[model samples]
Target: MSEMEVLVEVRGTLGRLTLNRPRALNSLTAEMVRVLDRTLSRWERDPEIACVLVDGAGERGLCAGGDIRAIYDAALVGDPAPKHFWRDEYRLNTRIKRCTKPFVALMDGIVMGGGVGVSAHGSVRVVTERTRIAMPEVGIGFVPDVGGTYLLSRAPGELGTHAALTAGQLDAGDAIRCGLADHFVLSDALGTLVEDLGSASADDVDTLVRRYAQEPPPSVLDTERGWIDECYGADDVAEIVRRLQAAGVESARKAAETISAKSPTAVKVTLRALRNARGLSSLEDCLEQEYRTSCALLSSPDLVEGIRAQVVDKDRDPQWKPALLDEVGPDIVEKFFAPGDDELGLSTVRECDD
Candidate 1:
C-alpha cells in the first residue's frame, strides 16, 4: 500500500474513493478516516461531482474494520487516539447517511465494523457473492459502533441480535435481507458495473445499477427468523441465552455457546445499545450513544485484553474481567451510556431528519 491510504479521483461525474491498504485488508486508520471525511466533504460541495463511489483497492475486501492494533496500542497507555478516531469516523458515518448526492458503495468484499459505516449508509450499496459482512466486536470486547446499533436495531425481527451476539458473517443474501445493502451484483460483473458508473450521469446511476443487479440467494437469517426472533427477543442476555439453548435448533444452541464465549460486558452492553437505538429517532442519536460506549470500552480491561488475545497474541482466549454474564451489573452497563466529559455530540452539533 502507498502512503496515501485512500486514493481519491474523479471519473466524469463520479467521485471515486478507493481504500488502498490491501495488506491490512484496508482496515481504517485515523488518517484514512480523516481523508475519507475530507474527500466526502469536498465532493459534497463540488458541483462537478454529481455522485460518489467508494470501494477497496484489493480483491480481499472493502475494509476489515478500524485499526484494532492501533486502538490496542493507544489503550495500553491511556492515549485518547482511539476516541479521537471514533469521533471523526462517526462523523463521517453521519455525513454518508445524509449525503445529498448519490453516494454509492461497492461493498464487494469483506465489510465489517468501520466498513459498514462507510458503505451501508450510502444511498446505493452494492454487494457481491464475495461480500462477507460482520460486526464481530464482541469477540474483541467491543460494542458495535459507527451507527451499527442503529442499523441493527431496525433489522427484521431479531436477526440483528443474533448477528451481534455471535459475531457471525453475513453473506450478500443475508446482508441485503438485513437491510445492510441495497443491490446484489455478481463479482464478475462488478468491474463492468463500475466502468458503466464512471461514465454515467448521476441520474442514470440507479438504472445502471439495476441493469446489473440480480436477486441474491435465500437469506439464512430469513429461514431462521422464527427461532431467532423468539430466542433473542428476551430483554436479558442470560434469558436470551437460556432461550437459545432450549430452542432445540442446533444453530440456536451454537449461538448460545458463542455468546457465552464473548466478553460478558460487551455482550450485555451491545444488547442494551441495540435496544436503546430502537427508541432513538435517527442514526446520529445512535452514533452519539455508540461514542459513549466506545469510550467506556477504552477504559475497560476487556478491550485491551480482548485485542491482545485475538489480534496480538492470536490466542483467541480473552480473559474478560467479569468472566460471567451475571457479573456484568447494571452499573457497568450504565457507565457506558452515561454522558462523558468529551462527547461525540453528533445530535448536539446538527439534527438529522428521521
Candidate 2:
C-alpha cells in the first residue's frame, strides 16, 4: 500500500481518518480531498467498518480548510483549476454530510473555513475548549462554501447572517449554541475517548459520547442574540448592513466595521447564498447551490483582488472593486448564483443505515 497524505486505519469496526498535514494546520489540499473521498467510499461499503472517526493530526485537530493558496495561485494565472477544487471538495463535503454510518468529528483546535465544512455537518460534532471555529472566507475575497450557506442559514436567529458577512469566530460554547457542534468535552480527554471508541461497538460509542459529553459554558454571544436578531433580521444584505450600522450597539458597530473591511461583492453573494439556502431541503442541495456560486465567483474580480490584498500582497488592505456595499448592485450579486455547466453539480453518495 502507498503511504498517503491522508492516513486511514481501521480499529475493530471503527474507521479512523486523520488529516496528516499538521504543519499547515492540516489545511486540506485537493489531493487530500480526493484521497478522503476514495477512502470514505471504500469504507461506506465495507461490512467491517461500522463507524467513522475523523480528526486532525498533531495538536491542531481536524483541518483549517481547503488550500486557498492553491486556489489563489490558480486564479493568478487564469487557470480553471480552482473550479475542479471546489467541485471535488464540495462532493466530499456532501459525502460526509450524507454518510450512512454514524460519523464523529473531533474538533480540538483551529476549526475554520474548510474545517467547518467537513465536521459541522457530521452526525456527531465534538468541540473542545481549545476549539476556535469561524468562516473567515470574506477576508480572503471568497464567500463561504462547503455547505456554509446551509449551516449559516440554520444558525440561531440572525447569527448566521452576521457570521457569514463578518467571518466571525465562534468559541466552543457558541459553536454548540449555534448548532455547529453537538457535544463539548475537554481537549485532554480526546485521546482516551478515541481509545475507548476503538474497542467499543457502535452502541458503546454512542453510550460513551452521551455519558461524557459536557454542556457548553455560557457564551457572551448568547446574551446578545436579541440584538443580533434585530440587526440581522433585514431581508437583504444592504438592509442588514444598514441595520447593523444604525443599531449603535458596540457589538453591532464592531461587526459592521469588520464586515466593511471584507470584499463587498463577496459579502453580498454570501448573504444571498445563505438566504437562498434557507429554502433548501437537504445538505446536498445547499452544497450544490454553493458550488454554483463558487464556480462563478472564481471569475469575479474581487476574489483575485481580495486574495492579493489579504494573502499574496500581505498588505492587509484590499482595494475591493466596488469597495462600498452599495456599489454591489443586486444584478451583480445575482450572477454568482446563476447556473453553470452540469460539471459543477454534486454527485449522489451511497446512503447507509446508521
Q: Report the number of the highest-TM-score candidate.
A: 1
Question: Could you give candidate 1's per-residue lDDT for residues 274-311 as a string of tens digits?
Answer: 99999999999899899999999999999999999999
Against the true structure, candidate 1 reaches a TM-score of 0.97
Candidate 1 overall Cα lDDT vs. reference?
A: 0.91
**Model 2, backbone clash pairs (residues 3+ apart or across chains), number:** 1
lDDT of 2 by residue, 1-354 (tens): 134568899988889999888888888888888888888889888988878989999887578898887888898788988887787788778888878788889988999888988798888889999998899888877888888888989988888888788888888988888889989999888888887777776666677876778878777677899879998887677777778889879889898888888898888888888888899888888887888888887878888887787767789878888888889898998888777665444535444221
Model 2 spans > 4 angstroms off: 1-4, 347-354
Instruction: After the best TM-score superposition of candidate 2, give how far the Cα of residue 348 lies from its true spot, in angstroms.
Output: 6.9
What is the TM-score of each predicted model, taking all chains together? 0.97, 0.95
How close is each model in CA RMSD to the real structure?
1.9, 2.4
- What's model 2's TM-score? 0.95
Q: What is the C-alpha lDDT of each candidate?
A: 0.91, 0.83
* Reference-based lDDT, residue 241, model 1: 97
